[model samples]
Target: MSEQWVETTLGEVADWSAGGTPKATNRSFYDGGDVPWAIISDIQNGPLRETAKCITPAGLDAIGGAKKVVPEGAVLVSMYGSVGRSAIARTPMATNQAIARGVVGTQVSPEYLFLWINAHEGQLDQMARGATQRNINKQIITAFPIVLPPAPVQERIVEIIGAVDDHIAALDAEVGALQGVYRAATSLLWGTAEGDEAAPQLLGNVMHLDVVRTPMEAGTTYRLAGVLNAGKGLVDKDEFDGADTEYAAMNILRENQVVMRKLTAWEGPITVVPAGFDGFVASNEFPTFTLADDIAPGWMKHVCRTPRLWAEMQSRVVGTVQRRKRLNPDQLLLVALPVPSRREQEQAAEALDAIEGQVAVIRAEATRLRKARAGLLSGLLDRTIDIESAELEV
Candidate 1:
């Protein structure tokens, strides 16, 4: 520990509070209403903003004045399940009792504090000492302390790190726009044959063609995870057995097949089952299907990962659980897929591959900058660099 490093409780510099849920019995409380309800899981990046489910004002009040609400930019620390993850509320929101709301004191800045808690999430876990669920209470937080720098120094330090975050957010938006450009380009190249100038043949009609694609063990395996990695198309096969594994019904694998994640947990993930995962079998929740060989596996992978097809899956899903939606296999088959000639698909894949490369670089840079920002905060709050030592031009 440095001379500036001080071991103390968090209770002294912040107001620590927990949240509760509204009565589930009251149906009138929930229904596409305006008030955004934040669950502990919703605090992924920071303080909660938008939520998957909305509750009415009545719903807000039903939980016994639980509406104290987490403020936009407030520090939120998870105390259950994914313990010790900390984030600053990005927007105004509310959370359940599983997260502790920390309002920092003048000696600390929320941005700096957010990074501090995140960088030291494991340390915060120490305060949570229970057996079943490690819970961090108000007393634990207020009493938990880290060495702090003078307020001016803290502000300067936060400013330095905040600039990096601003850039990362901008890059993310740019990558999203580029994807739209890619879709438009691909559709024009492969979508429809104009006016049937030449006979457009049905895929099933031409079964004996040499160019048709396939998966390793097509329909037999249940996919649990490892399907999609955003622009990465399909996540390369890796075992995902977190909850517990080894199912009796191991779906057989095939080559040139398309695997779609049915459960919302892996929803939106699609992959062209590669040969490397020749016999890989997934969980029952994932539904697998075959794509005809006439369609290029690479091109099909591009189209399936696009927003157009993914959004269509919403109406076909059914359930109320958080990971609720189940993709309709039959509904998926009927959907018109743009098929390109083997030669044309090869060209399209080349273009998509390039764009994906660009996105990957941007994404890697973003990750690096974010981690760098975290390191800066660790040094800032730890007081290795004093306020007087940091000279700011502005």
Candidate 2:
């Protein structure tokens, strides 16, 4: 520890309190409410600016009235689900019992405390106790160890971290704007209504199920992949030895081939096998298809991600149990897909791909910035890195 730093318990620097939930059964407590009723999910990266739900003044009264209204600038910590997630309240807000609010003393900066708490989320979560939903109580929270430097140092630390945060926020905004553009472009390219230039054709006409199976050989290892629900794309599920396998064979995935999880096809567990996942294996539950020569790989991949296609599959699903429902290969082929000329399809794909490529680059940078922030926070708090030496541009 730095010679100028002081070690103390969190309670010594902040007055701690927990909030309560208003009576849910009482309509007077919530109906037509304006008071922001914060939950664990609302305690995100920065300030508790707004919440998903709200409560009436009667609801405030139910939760101890004026005392329950956490003041703006207070640091809020989630105690239940997503335990230890921390944020500063940008506005006065009421919270459920699962959140702990801390009003910092003159000696401490709320922003500093919020940053420290967020960085130590894993430690606090470890202190939580529960089998199903882990949680920390007032005793554990109040006793959490804190390293406090002088007020000015705290402000400096917060300032350095805040710059990185701002950069990340900007990058996120860029991704969002680019995504909106991509959505508009794809909507035009893949319109539901038939246009004079677009000749709609049955999926069966342009694609066929390719039931290529790879027999598992003993002593060989296989990399397995699974399609993410809602068309997120293929993800590495696991790696297993062929000797331990229960099945005699697994479906082989080829690059640019379309694959879908038969069970959740209605919910869009479909994607084109990207470059890196080529030669990966999946179970029979995931069916594969080969597109015709005229079909653009990028176009088919976008179609897999479209919600309209998913909605169409939903009505075609079969099975008595909702969870067990499946969209069979034959049924999937029966749907009519809007098809344009090869040139138009390729042009649309290229445009959308360009926007997505930009988004991916920005996102990668944001991730790097986040990791750098974590390291900087650790170094600053431990006094290993001098405050004056810090130069976080973003």
Give the per-residue lDDT digits (tens) of candidate 2, residues 1-394. Answer: 3448889988788766423333445433333546566655566757764544765565555664223335445676655664344333433334322222333322367788887877777787778787667676679888888888888788889899888888889999999999888877776555423444476798898889997899999989999998998777999978888888898999999999989988966789988899999999999999899999988888888877788788878989999898999999999989887888667778777888898899999999999998998998998888777777786343
Clashing pairs in 2: 164-394
lDDT of 2 at 286: 90
lDDT for every model?
0.55, 0.75
Candidate 2: Cα lDDT at 10: 85
TM-score on alpha carbons, each prediction: 0.65, 0.86
Clashes of 1: 34
Q: Could you tell me the lDDT of residue 384 within candidate 1? A: 63
Angstrom error of the Cα, residue 317, model 1: value is: 10
Q: Give the lowest summed-lDDT range of ten residues in model 1.
A: 206-215
